[model samples]
Target: MTWDAVIVGSGFGGAMVAHRLISAGARVLMIERGDWVTRGEAAWRPEASFELTPSYARDIPYRCDRGGHGTTIGAVACVGGPSVYYGCVSFRFRELDFVGDADVVADSGAAWPYRYDEIEPFYGEAEGLLGISGDDAGDPTAPRRSRPFPFPPGELAPISMRVVETAVDMGLSPFHLPLAINHTASAARQKCVACRTCDTYACAIEAKNDVATMMIRPLVERGMTLWTNTVALRLEAEGTAVRRLVVHRRDSGEELAVEAERFVLAAGALGSPHLVLASKLDELSPARAAVGRYLMRHDNAMIFGVFPQRPDPTRRFHKQVALHDWYFGDPGAAEGAHLTKLGGVQQMMTPPKELVRAHLPLGTKTLLGGFTEQLTGLLCIAEDQPRKDNGVSVDWSIRDGYGLPQLVIDTSYTARDDLAVDVLARRARQILSNMGALLSYTHRVKTFSHAVGTLRMGTDPETSPLDGDCRFRGVENLWITDGSALPMSAGVNPSLTIAANALRAAAAMVAR
Candidate 1:
């Protein structure tokens, strides 16, 4: 049957659209490339998450030119996408983030066509809908919220509280990390166990409030049909609209042509562009040069501070403290003092023994395990400024198991991004030092976790692939509401922004 809307990818973007569109009494059909993830004890296995489990993460090979670093980008491919296994740092972008950075924008010629005020209400709607809970007091730089978070703040572990205490003493603004899990009976979420297996691992009891456990099932029950294990091969596009989709079923390898009046492309930054490029939409789009351009993934770093006190391994909730003292570049201060306007900082669960054993060397892993109870970590979610040059494109040279050109990610960060990482990582070290930590070290990577742009949203068709409402610039029936719609990724995680924009797009789609 031809539906009113066909939403692709059941992650935050697609899930939000499906929920809204179905609620509006529209016939909606959802397609997911990956099947549902592990549900029970298997979800708790850290060593085998990527190594053994059929989590269906796309192991796309990537290359970083300047640093000469290269590795496979393991983007999750499950129905709920990476939201099923995220750290739950749901934060709204600072207002200026949407307004665009004058310095960076001038240099790269990249800026959002819209501003924060337009999307502000949508942020609150997303928070309430997702049941986000946290203390907003610590981060004075946070955007003014229309309503308080859906639930009360989560309690912090002793080690994390200790770090917060020291950060406060050092004149830093620290508070409970904003989490999107059920914390009260009022919110109606599955009981949260607050386990250490939350950051990268799936929720064992389906209590983590991911899209699949929280939104997809309810939407399905309310008349939305979710086709899982379905890979979208290409779009059969006409003059100005998507006529139908040619999709491949992973289970039986059978091909099907599904028709819909309208389509919502929420297949993420990399995957969404692959579909468009493969459809040869570039040849038809007025913004062909910008189709897969201006990609931004925050240059992330983890700071592990070694304290003298031993942390209780039995307790699960460790990633509670957060610091947002430097939301933008530090202004003129004393000459010798360090300046940072790069990103926000937050606490993360201490690495479990199983994960530590799998990645670290024998001697180092053994020694680290001995002091495992003494290490606390801070994650730097830096704003890796967007550049038109870094993006995802079809690599016709190589084909995947699906016989299609594998998606290729070309991330060559600007010198400005390097500075952001340097300053943010340096500030993280200082925070731990002031807290009287024995040793503090950092590890940096171009993480696939928080990538944005590619099919960016803007008013200008020449510079962007989508309009302000996330509809493809020249395509009448195609819309995208994922990280791909973001013109610039701010210091915070991109999931909340993605969801907010999606809710906004759903409103537009239903209005028509």
Candidate 2:
């Protein structure tokens, strides 16, 4: 059965595209690499890390370049992709983000072909569709919204209030993080209980308004067909058109050819480029050199504040407060001269005792295990500049279990990236200190959780792999609506932007 549109990967991008296309009366088929996650007590267990859980894809390991040393990184492959385990912090990029700095463009050749107005309405649509709850009153950096958020921000937890108080005392305005979760009681879904296991774990009560819960389930009911555990091997292209997608059904152990009138590549920044290279699409593209270049993942780290007493005696969710005072360069401060395009900082929940013990040294593990409740953290996310050398590539010499070349990642933070994160971390440490923290520990994030910009969209076919509308330069029937299409990694969460752009791209396809 040929579909009107075949979508690969069901995260924010693919889900939004499918939702829009399906609503427009198009027959859609979604192919996901992993099956739907089983939401239960096992998924919310405090003793285990989600990385070691069955939901994470361990078989399709990719080599990540970490400061010259290569390490295997696990990939998330579930139906909703990483959204299943996300913290639901949905944010819209500011207007300044659309037009990148001239210095940045000179360095990375990164520029958004379209402006913020082009996709502004779609951002509202996405927020409404995802049931995003937020208040823009305190967020100075919040973009102009066409309409208010779907729901008002929920009440802050005790731990979040403490951080908010400290930030207020420091003359910094802190706002409630825009969250895409079921915070209100309704017949359609259960309200969030504010559990401790949120950021990296699947919501056992189906309260988190993830892509799977908000988009995929409703689309399936609306006649869209979804195939789980289906790995898209390669796209069979003819001239400038994609003919069919060859996929392997993990459950049946059979390979199948799926045909569709249109193909949407939303397999994230890494997976989409790997598929394109494996299929030799670059050989036919004028923008071949840009296919897997200009990768940008936000430089991120966590600053943990060790308190004398347990911060959260009740152990409730407190990933709420967000501060963006240092988003733009602050000329008044000494270090502000070096910081031009930094990101925001948000409150993070204390890690479970099990996780603390698992990662700490032998003697320190037992010592810190008892002090788990006394640790609260702040996550600093800084916008990292794109570089040509930091991107995804396929290694022809090595093949994975699927007989395809192994995917290799080449990425490292630039000096500016490090500086931006360092400034934000210093501010975070200060905030923790003001909150009566005895000591603070900084831990740098190595995972590509916020990765973007592998197959950037721009006006020039000679420089960018995708056109302004997210169509591949040579492949007429193919479109990329994932993180890969983003030209610049804005100083905010990219999930909402990805969803809005996917909606815009789907509208373009439907209109054509």
Please provide TM-scores, in order, for all candidate models, with all chains considered together: 0.93, 0.97
Error of 2 at 419 (Å): 0.4
lDDT of 1 by residue, 393-486 (tens): 7877877666566676777767767676666667788887776679975657555667789998887788888887888877899998889999
Q: Write the per-residue lDDT of candidate 2 for residues 184-268, one digit (tens) a residue.
A: 8888778999999998888998899999889888889998899999999999988789999999999999999999999999999
Question: What TM-score would you give candidate 2 relative to the actual structure?
Answer: 0.97
What's each prediction's clash count? 2, 0
Query: Which ten-residue region of model 1 has the weakest summed lDDT?
Result: 60-69
Q: Report the Cα lDDT for candidate 1.
A: 0.78
Model 2 Cα shift for residue 208 (angstroms): 0.2
Q: What is the lDDT of every predicted structure here?
A: 0.78, 0.87
Once superposed on the true structure, which residue ranges of model 2 sit more than 4 Å away at CA? 67-70, 359-369
Q: Best by TM-score, which number?
A: 2
